[model samples]
Target chain A: MSDVKTTALVWISPSTWPACVDAARERAPDDHVVLLHVGDDRIAAEAHRAYAGLLGRGHGPERDPGSRLEALSGVAGADLLEKAAHRLGRPCELLDRHGRPQEEVIRAAADADLLICARDGDPERPGPHSLGPESRFVVDHAPCPVLLVWPHRT
Target chain B: MNSLAAEIVSVGLLLGVLAFAVARPRGLPEAVAAIPAAGLVVVLGAVSPADAWEQTHTLLPVVGFLAAILVLAQLCDDDGLFDAAGDLVARFCGGRPVRLLGGVFGVAAVTTAVLSLDATVVLLTPVVFVTASRVGAHPRPHVYACTHLANSASLLLPVSNLTNLLAFTASGLTFTRFAVLMALPWLAAIAVEYVVLRRFFAADLAVGAHPPKEAEQRTVPTFTLVVLGLTLLAFAVTSLIGIEPLWAAFAGTAVLAARALRRRRTTLPALWRAASPLFCLFVLALGIVVKAVVDNGLDTGISRILPGGESLTTLLAIAAVAALLANLINNLPAILALLPVVAPAGPGPVLAALIGVNLGPNLTYVGSLATLLWRRVLHEHDSAPSLGQFTRLGLLTVPATLIASTVALWGTLQL
Candidate 1:
């Protein structure tokens, strides 16, 4: 175990980018921040191929699906984390994990003192007040205390 | 323990497992939660070992059929058929947003009717979203259409849904007769859906169409298209010959799998991964659980409440109840519980129940597995529709479609 502490683990998605930024802003200057984004490789590959097909292509690139999705999510995460770190005037680490969003988030939260996430609202609900399946699971099972940001106002 | 207490304990245990399966926290696969519950039933003597074995026998065909359809859908996806269809839909719109909505409805209905609702949710949703994005149209209307039409439009053919298959088997109607009876209801349901969806999504539907960029354009596979057409033809032919439809589905799956395998487009392991045996296990376990409930006198009350005539009033009443039950529990379990009750009333009521099970799930998030799967798909893609939004839409559309389709079913039966 390293003597240095990683205080907060923030789960970021394209939808939760703003909430993640807000969490980063709230962190103490000495607090170590690790921002994580989880993406489904299969889904990303499907979307990629579907996008390529829509553009008159037969298939997507023949690269490894897992790495491609990881890279894509990594880039998106790094971009947002970099912006957050620059705003906080400190360095932040971007962690990209591949799998179901809730599972990966729960696994990553084991090492952190605090987990920060936004309620990913369910589409069936009228407003952003309701919690999504992933967010609900994270709040319930994350190893550390969770700070859930409701970014969508009533 | 006394036999009575044991039975009660077993039933309670099974329901708990089912609730977990339905809630599916942490995204546990349905099969993973269900199979163990099934094992519990046998261990508790809620169902005898022999009865459990018999249940497996009954489930094998349904599993095989669903697995085959799933494989076919995945392979078709790998072949870029859905994307090609999506492109065609965009082209057909010719840059109009409303037309794009219409195009999406048509393609989604056909996809749901042919490939099953799950397939539409899995394979077509992303394409719909991407297409909507490309055109700069509101993705909500187009993307939402995939889930709604996937449920409402699936009432048309027996192959369109698992619930429909159950009803078709119970109806004792020939395949052609079943389609004939459902044809009007299917049309009526789709019309009601179109009117409601257009109204609710009116603001979102009004956008300028943008054609697909050069990169998204691809040559559609003419051979695959032909094969799909022939496979559909084979379904009709198999039905006419008194052969089970699963045979045709299996044959079609084999042909498609062979082609995809030969071309090195897909692998055998991919097939296994695509189809979950755990889901089959889940269904079988649910059956045993439902059987335990039914054996404990659930059926007596159900049969009493079931409408007893072929009259339009009776059909409507039965459908209303079925829809209510489906909304309360899921349609799969609802259908399992109520099938015996409805089947006794004749084909008319059986089908009316089918209509309810298929359409009623649109009322809530947990009403059907397909809707849950649709939600998961949207979440994965970073788009979430609020539950209130879904419930509101369901409130508006479900009753209207249910009534319209039931009336249509009555009229068809009269004809």
Candidate 2:
């Protein structure tokens, strides 16, 4: 496990987890993979935080709808991380950060030797070439080299 | 014209800066866009420092009133007022798309009338989309309702739109009088929009609906609602007593702010951060620029052709011209340009011009700042309405609503 010198951080969403894992393995086959799921809880949590702060309830992110997505990401991400480790025969780590996904992915990439991500889907455009704004932002701003796996053209 | 060159420079700088602010290159914030133009007017001596101070002083009450309304809206939004409204509509509609459309109109109209059109656009658009999705309805009609009603329904009250506030200030009508004169036009505009929107989206509205999941309902904030009622009542009472509406707004704001602070729901710094002083500065700066235009012969130039009469025809003509001008350069500047031109013509035409500036902006995407903001909000939700689609709807709705509402205003004057 410690023998693998390469470290890859892969951003995972529930929809994009499978493609991300595959892309991560393809980029660094012998590298230790760390799956990072960034929950989008900032907007609603800000509202809740203000509401709770006013009332002194101090409710955590769990009470918001965003946490449900975070929970799903965690469960699916861990399972995918486990499968990827088995296939690569190396130890892998699964981590979750909650906030703006792109910002979290960038911050979590501090120790990552390579950043892996799937070209996230976009509801605004219908085509094989469409890219989510977050994916574009990550590609443009990521400090480390980014490997974006495009979805298979239908 | 001792200050001809200075006035030209002032107007030129104001127009250029306003365009930049509206276009907002590099995602500049609102204050960043508005504040510098204000500073330039003073620095250029186009507006004397003493006059700038006087102009800003006049705008203070309006700013305070608007800020308080904004705080109230934000607090209501935080307490899930909009989300709960959406959920109630979804649950109560029994998954019927048409009923849901009615619900959307109702919620958007009330939100616009009470909290301002900005609130309707910013807070209610996404909730409408989510509710439509949950019920398996086509979201287009419901989504369009948010923008259409935001403009048309906002005609009823002085606080409904910033333009209304400006008109209110200029008309010198008490709060109750403004509401009375606008009541018929407001109904007319909303009715026209409702009929047009339903017809345009008839095909979409015919889709089968899905059973909505039971949404967790939060208790409506009865205390907040009661305070809102008292605030509105205070508007009428203060007007009767010849007090500025600002005092009433401030009273309500103080109560709400105190409650929030005591309950530890929000902080003073947060409220201060949210309240923009730049808007007051922008209004003052724009007033100075418009004064320059008025001084440099634009007023006299407009006056010669400015159909002089007290007839309904005259009122409608002024409204028609205003509507056209609003489409040309957007409503804010148009109103700033036309206000002095029409004010001397008296209150009937001024209110008609108000109708034109308020309802006419639905004619084009660039007709108002609220529309621009509405478009951006829609884009964030991944539902940008195409320009052609927006125009087509606007063409169907704007003229009909504008004419009908102007006619209603004429009727009010007759009464």
Candidate 3:
């Protein structure tokens, strides 16, 4: 063997985090694992729009609940990443990002050898419906090879 | 311009303005659409310059009151009134989701009735969302209560909704008399909403968990509560003193803004922005556009369709038509279109139309500006209910509340 380990990027979401983590450990045992969690800021943007629409854009940022929500989401995202790292119980790089979750995952996977994620849609189905829109987009657009795992045994 | 061409152009311009207002293409301010449309109407000779000026003059007080209330609501939010209410609700619910739902309903009703529906959506929705998450309760039911009551519970006071404010000006009733007339209807509508929401979201409310220990330590802001109480008292006093109620709202906003400023909680620029000159201008411009439409003979068509009388059947017909029209063209314009026609028949029809415009928005997202704002709030909190789900709930609640409240209004009229 050349003794060069593969780099795997594992995408973590609140719903299917365990499956991705387990896949990283089982299939890429000796690989360098990078755990990625993306905080969706669309909600924050939506809140800002609501504020601007009703309250006007002149109000200071301190009065906006959108920025407050974004901060809270960041804290929650970090906490989740920590919990995910703890569950992996092995050395891994934790990458926390914000924006569209699928786009962030695809961007983070650019330097990795493999992208690992879980099917987040209908568990009972056995077709494309099994993947959510974000995961579907990630699978279709990822720069690296992808390992898609079922969240639970069907 | 010939009368026929003027009428066609005026209607076309009005439609374009409403489309831009509703779609808000690329998030432009509503005034961006309305001001231009208003100018076009005047310039096209669809409305006389004198008529447009008259419309602006008539709308000044309503717009002034609206600005004051927006400021008051923002300062109150800055003072932590909504957060305190949410915290109190979470603390008292004792980890039961159903109880939390009821608590949210009560608080939302009061907030909408007192501060207007926009406050409940823009300020209280996020607080309730955070509170639900902290308590480990599913947030759907609680947050839905905020939006639903923002529309239905707004039946109580003239100041509760912008539509009510318009109707109040045209209805020629004292503030106390308006509240007294709408009191029973408000109670009935709220009751129907509570019952329907509880049953609709029963599964979500079936489970609950205790709030995190840290959440329990949050303190309520007492000074804000006292000021709010005194503000409510001032509304009644100002009404009795025979002055525009905007004075009371201005006083409340001034006191709260001063306290917020002294405490370094808010700034003057922030206060000015919260007052939202763009939105005020949108309202004024909208008034001019609507005047152009009415002047072009839209009211004659509306008058033919709207039944004229104060009888129970007539009230129901007026309310039903108002509700349908409200859903078709957002409530603000709907009320504007219907008011001139209904106001001539007296307070009974005007109040009935009020009930319709206020309660009708529960049926669709586009039914009211407050509903649209509430939808945005829900989307940001990651708890957006689906269109189908929202409509199903509306179908269950709107008809029941409408009939119950209209009957109640007719009963009050009898008294």
Candidate 4:
């Protein structure tokens, strides 16, 4: 009945997975927390499809988009969700979507009450790229409120 | 030279400097910086350097206090004290973009007021950018808020940052008096900025709002206390020994830098780099303005244009002109140029004008170090609305600040 239960998707970045999971346990209700990500399988498929289009080759074996990232993200997402559920002493669902990372994350938000993201990443950017377009796009159009979780500043 | 010839010569030379700076400003950040200090030097060179650089033993305590304050601030930041403070603000605002903007501004004001603006900006800019992405809001509004906070917070204390430090020391205003002039106008600017920016930010953006269960709470093994004690001790010792204040500051910074590292914890290179452009600009302006004063004398005809016997009236007039000039020429030279000529204007005009010059940058991109840095970051390799973006912001800010500033000056004198 409170303001927080409406959160629908909890997205975890690899570095911040620990912190986001912890925030969710405290704030998200049982069953309200869904671990969602754009599976690497989906991204891989997109790349393959593009390659085939360029070369005019026969249809390649069906490949999921972001196949590798999806696998890695899946393991990370599942591990954190399980750890969080255990800590909260509750049950939670792991929702994975195989597509471009941004689209899948948006779709997950559509089904949930709120979207929570853990802000765990390399402190400095690799070069000048900061807040890639996908993150910027999702922020502008997410279906519901999203929380940016970080190690609570001092 | 005849008076007319001198006036014409001043105008011609002034136009030349502006044209040259405009023709290409980016490549010569250092030389552009050197101009103000160099100009100040020329002015002082023309005058009695002994008088312009004169030391009054009684004035020494204020300098010492500012140096000590910087050490204390460095310690608190090293411990990340402001992070908890940010969470508290975020918690209060909940999930609304507008509420969050206001909260961020409020916290930034206090933080920048307590520490220097550079420290506040360094700690907060990364967090704000990340937080904006999390909340799904454009970083623009938050970026604007950060800059505005710096501007408003500039007036908070004599030791809050260099502009206030310069204004206070050059004009002989006290700490509490400086804060008093700044309080209302600073708050008003924050309120206006938040209100204007509210609708433009993302809709109820929230970066993960919860804290980690295991977040660290340990204190930084402190050189803060040691630094503070040493700074104060040195300050006292220096005044007794009659060391110049600038040299004393440099000595303290060297002493602290030598011992600040713990277990090879690297000192933040960003700390020195973050505000150097501004410091260089200030030093450079100090040189130029001193030179100008030497040529002009303490009461050039222009300096006495107020035509009023009232100290308050004259003071306000000087501050008003100084603020306007600072936008084009920038505050360093503007303040350096005016501080000696203005006589003692009570803490009122001195405080108000200092607020105006520091905040005046809000009116244009080139106005203050904070605005210029933001402009560069946002523009980066590509130009986003270019310098014109800053000019527009300044157009709004200059009139708004001046109007609010006039009221503050009037009220201060009334009280």
Best by TM-score: 3
Stretches of candidate 3 off by over 4 Å are A1-154, B212-216, B367-386
TM-score against native, each model:
0.70, 0.69, 0.76, 0.55
CAPRI band for model 1: incorrect
Of 2 and 3, the candidate ahead on lDDT is 3
- Please provide, for model 2 over B1-415, each residue's C-alpha lDDT reduced to its tens digit, 9 standing for 90 to 100: 3577766776676566555545444544334544677677667766677876775675666667777777777667666778778888887778667788888988888889888876776567667766775665655577677767877898888888777777777788999999999899999998899999887766456444655775555466777777878999999999999999878877877787788889888888766644544544556566666666665666776677568865878877887888887776566667777887887767887888888887777775344443454357446755442455567788999889988998998888889
DockQ of each: 0.03, 0.03, 0.08, 0.03
Worst 10 residues of 4 chain A by lDDT: A51-60
Best-fitting candidate, measured by lDDT? 3
Model 4 ranges off by over 4 Å: A1-154, B1-78, B81-88, B199-259, B267-285, B288-290, B297-301, B307-317, B368-392
lDDT of 3: 0.79
Q: Model 4, residue B368: what's the lDDT?
A: 39
lDDT of 3 by residue, B172-272 (tens): 88788899999999999999999998877654454434655663565677887888888888878888989877788888888888989999999998888
Model 4 residue B130 CA deviation in Å:
2.0
Which candidate would rank higher by TM-score, 1 or 3?
3
At residue B185, what lDDT does model 4 achieve? 62
